[model samples]
Target: MKISQISVFLENKNGRLAEVTRILAENNISLKAASIADTSDFGILRIICDQTEKARQLMHDHLFTTRVNDVIAVRLDDRPGSLAAIMTLFEQNRVNVEYLYTTHIGQEQRSAVVFKVEDVERGLSILRQNGMETVKGF
Candidate 1:
């Protein structure tokens, strides 16, 4: 119903993103999905990984600012308007989505979306009621 996501604050500079990936690779942390939202000064690197706790610990040890939070991973049909349909469900339920990212898990006809919402529990309930399959892990 919920998945752990790590958000790392990165300074907007060359090799900063590489540093994060390098650290994760060195520690064997596999990324399932990732998204970066950036401004002029910094960026938020949001990632879903195979190992959440270890990734967070490694990032912290390497002196990177990181935070762990739960996001809903909803399984969706890989077709037109699939995302719009899900957005409609959330909108009708009054659940605000802060952000979202998509990933495919070895399925050509289906994909999963990770959504960060205002109320995770309520969002999950709404999505479930709407017949959306929510995944548990990356």
Candidate 2:
């Protein structure tokens, strides 16, 4: 139901994103999914990595502004109506999605949507009742 997400604060200037990626690459942290939310002068890089704690520690050691948060990652069918169905479930339950990203897995067309929901447990239960699976990384 709950997963960890790393939010790295970066300036809106050039090379800022490159710096973050370089650091992660140097540390061998695999980014499974990522999204950037920008404001006027800065942006929050929300990232799901293979090794979250280590990535956080590495960022801290490098003096990168960052925060760790709990989120939800749901696997959905890749067909056209799949997303609609999932969103309908959440809509019916009034689950607010703060952010979301998706990626394909293996050979299957089905995709996994990583999201930050308003209510973790309730969202999980709603998804459970609808037969949706949550991906939890160790």
Clashes of each: 0, 0
What would the per-residue lDDT of candidate 2 be over residues 1-138, giving only the tens digit for each residue? 688899999989999899989999998888878889999999999998889999999999989988998888777764678778888889988999887877554445456888788888888888888788887652
TM-score of 2: 0.90
TM for candidate 1 is 0.95
RMSD of each: 1.3, 1.8
Q: Best candidate per lDDT, number?
A: 1
Candidate 2, residue 30: the lDDT equals 83
lDDT of 1 by residue, 20-111 (tens): 99999998888989999999999999999999999999999999999999999988776799899999888888899998989876534458
